[model samples]
Target chain A: MTLSLPNLGLGIGWRAQLAHAILNRPDIGFVEILAEDYFLSETIPPPLQALHDRGVHIIPHGVGLNLGGAEPIDPARLAALGELAQRMQAPFVSEHIAFVRAAGLETGHLLPIPRTHAMLDILVKNIRQAEAALPVPLVLENIAILFDWPNAEMDEAAFLNAICERTDALLLLDLENIYANARNLGGDPVALLDRLPLERVAYVHVAGGYEADGVFHDTHAHPLHEEVVALVEALYARMAVPGVMLERDDRFPDDAELGTELDAIAAAIARGNIERHERGFAHPVLSDAS
Target chain B: MMSASREAISDTQADLVRALVHGTPVPAGFDEQRVQAVARSLVNKRRQALARIWPSLVKRVGDSFIAKFTEYGQTHPLPTSANALADGRAFLAWLAVKEPPTDDLRIEALAYDLRWRETPLGLCRRGGFGIKIARLAQSEKWLLGLRTPWRGDRWWGMPANV
Candidate 1:
């Protein structure tokens, strides 16, 4: 299966609080809406409608899919995504590979799944179920875990790649997650980046977090860190992914601050593009056609 | 050996969630300290998410919202079929049992009564509820300056069943 993953360039996660900033700004290549926000609504919110008319790509990103759960995918949830995709006319709808619910319990946040073969098989099947029911491609994002499963079968990259390979899913590699995991879980972010199939990365996420008592958490409310931007630069240098985005959920800074972060991201991406051109990296079209 | 069936994977994931939100023991093989850290962070995140949904409730709880929600979150789990507002309502319902029922929480639940309710599958909008009560609830929220009362043609024109 082939996906025409657009080169989304620099995008931001669409939030109502930031609606004015996003609509007024000219440089943002796309905006991602949390699919759950719009899925249950009967009609398009006026602000989102205005953004859609502005012509920038709007992707519906979901956190409630719980694709790794042992239970069956929720049909209403899948149906809602289909409705949203059709309304938004999105190229793809993305969700975390992590599960949010189990045994009729909703965690309300993404919980990491064990990296064993059994869990991988379950995730693959769940992803297929979501893929089959959704109107557009369902790209899966790698979630940040504070701890590693004791009885894991493979490294994070391998397990993520395995799921992508088995289900023919695209990747929403979150660089902040990689940085957080590398710092907390003990691994080299760049090396992990090098090991994964960059071809599968549909887009990347760069966000800010807080560090407390020598520990870093991807809170997404604070300002984007210099180290996180450096990680984005590192990823860009290696893969030249088709797109990258900024996600800020709380502690939203002023437009001046947001513009600075977005510019830093664009600059990093530009630097990587230059490196790719100098190294004679293939011109990215839809696929990794080198 | 534990079977690697889909059921096993599901159960383990459930166990992990239990550890994170419900105060269940950390499953073997995970870094106990780090998983506990993540679980704590998850509770904090819930506070943040619900704060946006019910700002007054958090403001009233002051320093205790995190502690209260952490205690409430253990068994309440989130509403599977509802959104933040409904989940906020559920949290208050849980709180009503744990702490004294504040007018703020009750009023908030009433506000949600104006919006939607829990269904077997998910939250569906209210039906058959009196528009007069919905209007009264809107006016009560106006006192908090929470939202503009449904006024002019907007509030009255909405179908009672819709």
Candidate 2:
């Protein structure tokens, strides 16, 4: 299926602390606002309004939808997200393929769901419900899991593919999450990327993490890891990525450090583009002998 | 394919959530070590979030912040409001029962107490009029806080000599 998503180019997760830095940078193509932050406000925050007026795409990213839960999607939360999307004039809103709350308890963190077919069925139902209610297209993101559930079922990529295929929803692929999962759980990050439905990816999230007690935590507070940036290069070499953004949630650094990280990502994309072109030039069908 | 009905999935999720947040036993078939790791990670995340919202509370609590907050979190699943301020308010209320509040803590708790009301649902912001008088623990000074729907919050502290 053709997603027809716009090429959002290089972007950064819109954080209040980094608002001044983001506004000063004219090269930033888009900014993703946490939907819940603006849900209670009657008017758009001035900085966000200025960004919108500047023609930077603002995507309402939600953290509370609990799409992977067995229970039906909460109508009120879904409505708030939709309203925020409409208010922001977002191109498409994004959410995780993980559950945040269950059994009247808020975990305050996205918890992984079992990858069983039954769970897949539940995710599809929830995604469709969200898609129906949202004013724009809905993109689902893969969350970083500390551990996988004990069950006999599909792997992460296959489960994501199934969800997107069934709902026609786009993917908000997070490379840092894939890296953290592979580092914590046993898997090859590059191989996992090969299996994902990259064509359905609407954007990409690259962030930083640290390993403690042999476990890599996807804490977006640190500097972007070189390995995660390499994943960005690897992803771009495979296919055309619509958008890629940096997600730094805490322990924010100054503008120069953020600029360096963004530069690294841009350089990776450039290197990947060069490799892609060279590979195309050397294709057997386009050989000089022909 | 292992087929789990919706009810089964719901029950399993509840069990996992309980294990992670409520200090319940790890569910069968799951690795105990990893579950513990995740539980710790969740607590750390919550601690960071709460610290962000209530820096003074965490700072005043000092070295014991993590221990206190972790203890508080195990019993009280995060409030449904999902607002850090509400969670912090709830934590302050819990702390008041466990230990005597410092003057700073008392004043912080008073600000929130005067500005919002705790209901069965969650913390609701005061819209009309409210007044709270708190005596500081260390200084033995009285603090008066007033909240008006239109005028916003105002606080007056007794003179240092008092």
Candidate 3:
């Protein structure tokens, strides 16, 4: 079962570098705000408020909630995310299937979790905990894996299905990640795309990356290659996803350079046959500012 | 039964992250070459991230920055918290001390700390302290973002900024 969210047509990952740019751009429909990037506050940040005023949807995308860890989810972190979602008036929120930390140790980057039945149990338990705390639906995103676990009982598709089935959570399918993993690990990205649950996807993420030593790290700071763009087109043909956005982290380019990528993403959607340019939000939903 | 499986997950997860960031051995049945490649790439990511927070350090350290930064990471666990900017700050403070006590190093630390503030968001410019710190420090022949910190300290065992 999928909870319906606002289809903020073509959006960009909320970034400070492009903050002013987003305000003036009409084609931009939504912004996926990095949940951890903001300071913990009871009130909305100025930039997001500015976008909200202009009729743009903001989704709180989190990176640190390690849901796949063997331990129970942190109540405080879950609370923080709930507050962030309420503050943004976002329809849904997202965290990774990967773990950011293990027990007491922190990797400071998304680390791969073993794909096992035991792993699925912990994920379902933590996901349910988060779903209970948050006022909105929590969508779990699949991360780019650099390495694999020895004891994998299933492939990425089956494992993802297991978690979504058990918890009834939505998926934020990142096409760039699918392409990257396939390119690095040797598989057909298209085949992986064909098998996954597209109906559960609330939105899609198309980002660029830097390649070194024949491995493409989903850096998002670089430009999307032609092959990955084709994968986006393929995903569009197969599934009519509601939203697709561009994500960039650092080494931010000039306005024109970034805008071109956003445009490319929008065009990719058309080629994929997702032609609905309409937005779901009728009026701006405002929470108490003070 | 559940508890035993949980322990297995916990131990393996820890071992994997340790292998990636700490240069430990890869777990069995995993591709060793791919795991090693990932470890190096992760270290590179760490270096690039640190470079953004501590740009002058990267510039100052020149070619040896990667080796020095890798050495540092081997000893210190980079915090996985969202406050990577703050953790980067702590690393800079640590870098300042280990930097052989030079004028440029001191100036970098002093100027960096004075000019930036850890706010609710991230490291932001301290209000009213932007170019003034750089200007004042520059007037003392300590070039901000221009000169390397460890260039001339070896001759005197210390060349104070003043």
Candidate 4:
């Protein structure tokens, strides 16, 4: 399957606390909303509607789909997500490759599934189910895991590739997660990037985190580390990244700080484009900018 | 290649979740330290979420809030409905049992109860008419909470002398 995704440009996660700040920024090309936030509301929130009115692409991102759970996908949640996408006129919706619940319990956190072939089969089935139910194309994201399951059939890259390959789901590669996993689990972030199907990456998520007790935590509450910014540079240097956005979940700073962080990301992307250009690689989307 | 069946994967995933939230033994072959770290992180995340939902409760509990909520989280997994307000109400209920609810805390709890009703699924907005009252902890003062279908909520705090 081929994906002709648009270049979303630089964006930020649409949060209520940051709504005013985000709207004030004229450079934002897109915004991602937590799908569940509007499940009960009859109409889109005014700020979001305003963003939509201004022609900013709003993407509905689901956090509770449990797409990798052993249980079957929740029909109601899938329908709600589809309805939300249709309401928002989203180009494509996104969900994690991890599960948030299993059995009769809810973890309230995204948990990793074993990367075995059997597990991969389950993921593919779930993704296929979601793809059939959603209004638009589905994009899956790799979560930051604290630990790997006991035995795994494939590495992260191969497992992610298989899921995308089987389901034709686009990728929302999160650079902070890659950095955290590499720091905690021992792997080369750039090497993993090389093995990944960058062409499938519909967008990218860049966030901040901190290390404690010798382990890096993807808290999304801190400032963007220089190392994560460098990963952004490395990724953009490799492909014509369609979209890249910042996700700040907690400890939000002032508007100036957020704008500064975005500028840094833009700078990194430009640097990557320069590198790609110098290497004689031509990308139609980034040609004029590079 | 050893292929895991759906049922097997289901059980394994259940076991892993149980360990993370219920403080069960770490699944074999997984790093115990890493599992513990994840478990801690989950607990902290839930606590932070609860604090956000119940700011008054957190402020009242002060430094003891973390320890109290952490204890409540060990045995009680998050509400299946995934409603932050429901989780906060559950925590408040548990807290009330351990310690007498202060007037402020009681008022806060009553305020939420006025607007939302706890259900098996989660917290749902009360649609019909309902009345709630609470006696002040330190005085003879009484608080009246009235919920209506259309007008939202109305509260009256009795005079201190009354």
Candidate 5:
């Protein structure tokens, strides 16, 4: 159910360090920007706009909507986000299905929610609310939760399927988060994906995370490990996911380092037997800039 | 009679998690339960604060700062403040001057916030002003990312371009 996308093969999260390098080399498939970064009416992040102009398919990934929270979705925030999406012409926007705020309490982190029918009802309503406010499809990612409720009503797969089924939105399957949760929580990644409605996946996110006490935290700072790359290959082999974005949040490396990772991601895709790289974008990179 | 397969968590531990989560009172009998509770609460509080604030804050600062705040909140969970704002300021200040954070739980909590929130910069600026913590401080040879305040107590370092 992915909306009409521009066919971004391998994208990178927009970063200041890699901006010049990317603009100079414009060979990567696309660029995914944190939507809020470019939302300001008075001022905009120049690099993001440049990427959008450069024919980079600007995919938006959000941080703080807290879609899975018990609280009602904040309409004001959604309005601003919608305006940003319209302005950017983003194909898809994503957020995690975890709560950042509680009942009268704002923790400011993506807290795990109890996977009950009661919670699923809350999630469906929230996603619909977000979808109504924005023209773009609201893609939800599976968070790498550290804790599980003692009274979970459904497995992770069933919970997500119910949400997407109701909302009619797409899934931004983050392979790294899935792999991380499989290791941390007691779940099998392959089986979980098998149960999920893979036809709804709009795209895939692959990132590097740090390991601690044998648990991998989705830090997005380190290089993507071989295992995650393999998992990504496996997922692509099963589904025709149109795009992939590699995210890095901290300890940002030089341009060459990022380029290498982008290359590696593309290589992994080819090895996975994802064909049809020949059809290039009709618009030239420079002609698309505002 | 041996203990049950899983012993009941002591009240003290539950209280610690509560205090950590809700900013409730913690009477000082520190036991293992208290420790676990405190850790859980700290993680939750840190995430909440980050979730609530990261969107606006990241816009003002950089992505690097998301990690910085997360590190501070998790490591300094038994914060010297009553709520999220004060706790965030104190944690940021602590992070600027303290040695690098090493705790895995703390780092995990930090990563969660970075992934979860798009903290507005305006809130971060208010927080910085409230705590009198400056994002940048000047030293002789280098510009330190010190968490010291600009016009508040414990002022150090020369003015910019000195």
Candidate 6:
């Protein structure tokens, strides 16, 4: 899909396992890294430096901001993030619109925040704080949460749209999360897509998820599911999403397997080549048509 | 009726930071019920996502390990202040200068923990538990730190009296 970012194309999550392979063969799309990993040290990891030397556009994704909670953004974290961004010369940096802490302590996992007006205000403020701290525009990703907050006052799409609008932040739309949310909560994934402000989305994340009993878990172990692929294809029709990266947190496939998945995502993006104005048909194979 | 600044959290929100600096438990003030409730929720979410890969972490390290680390991380953003990071670096330094006994299983386990368990990220990798300690200690980042340590990597101090 065409995107605002330069040379926006398919990419993979910057992982440690495939570092050698990636550096050796630099034909793959851009790489997205978790911001915290590179910040603690002044010197970049040799492999990352090698990738950078090879002209790889690295984007940083953060996990510990705890942005959508009652707590305020920590300046040290922001400064470190800003430092990492500057050092890496990252195209952009992003974090989840969820809280990792409550009552002034880390909860470890990215916890869902109540999608209320107050929560929205807090998230937007945190984004602004982060944006002000860094030289780049901050993007907010919608997380894959298993439960809804009891106090949620608005729907996820509206909350996301409103946050993006208010903070002037870009959206890192994770298609797997939307699919997982739809399966878990019984919502129309496409409708949720239609509800979001697609124009603001700057990047897309496609990851594999697992199913326990009937519940879909946003575990990145498995291969990219067909449904998430279709959702991404559908969204690309309206938005010029720049970077589409594959996120696998477990059971990292060999370069061959990862290559296949990346190829599939790239092919799907080409096949659906639905322009901005066209209402495209989903590939029957990937569509959830019973 | 709160101002935006009311939401500000000093590095204190990170649990590991509080515990390391203040000697607090992972979740310092919660009663048993509240602690149990949060723990249960965390375990439930982690059971499938993380447990499937590291089947024994919950039992061996307990579910609160990450929460504890993240908390400490909040306060100890720099490597010097983080005891855990310091200790982790020390293990590497020890591995570099000394030879671990090959015969002892307990030493082997310590070696195992040293290689994989020190950092939550490394431990989470698939089959990451089996990596050798010497190699792990000598990873590019850790090695870089030993020579010219960064804020997150461990430090090796020169003797005060040269």
Assess candidate 3 and give its lDDT: 0.73
lDDT of 6 at A60: 81
Clashing pairs for model 3 are A108-B80
DockQ of predicted candidate 4 = 0.61
For model 3, residues A111-226, the per-residue Cα lDDT tens digits are 77878888888889989998998899988888887777777888998888888778868889888888888878767788888777777787888888878887788998888777
lDDT of 2: 0.84
The residue pairs found clashing in candidate 1 are A150-B29
Whole-model alpha-carbon lDDT for candidate 5: 0.61
* Model 1 regions lying over 4 Å from their true place: A281-290, B1-4, B60-67, B97-105, B119-123, B127-162
Runs with alpha carbons beyond 4 Å of true place in candidate 2: A281-290, B1-4, B114-130, B135-142, B158-162
What DockQ does model 5 achieve? 0.07
Among these predictions, the greatest TM-score belongs to: 4
- Give the best candidate by DockQ: 4
Question: What are the candidates' interface root-mean-square deviations?
Answer: 2.2, 2.6, 3.3, 2.0, 9.8, 8.7
Candidate 1 overall lDDT versus native? 0.76
User: In terms of lDDT, which candidate is strongest?
Assistant: 4
Q: Model 2 clash pairs?
A: none
Model 6: residues >4 Å from true position, as ranges? A1-4, A274-290, B1-162
Comparing 2 and 3 on TM-score, the stronger one: 2
Candidate ordering by DockQ (highest first):
4, 2, 1, 3, 6, 5
Write the residue-wise lDDT of candidate 2 on A57-127 in tens digits: 99999888899988888888888889988988888999998988777888888888999888888889899
Considering summed lDDT, which 10 consecutive residues are worst modelled in model 6 chain A?
A: A281-290
- Indicate the DockQ of the complex predicted as candidate 2: 0.50
Question: By DockQ, is 2 or 4 better?
Answer: 4
lDDT of 4 by residue, A72-112 (tens): 78888898889989999998999998988876888888888
The reply for model 5, stretches above 4 Å from the true place, is A1-3, A39-43, A274-290, B1-162
lDDT of 3 by residue, B12-68 (tens): 878777887777888777788887877776656777877765677677667877787
Question: How do the predictions measure up, each by TM-score?
Answer: 0.87, 0.91, 0.81, 0.93, 0.67, 0.68
Query: Relative to the unseen true structure, what is the C-alpha lDDT of residue A32 in candidate 6, on a scale of 0 to 100?
Result: 86
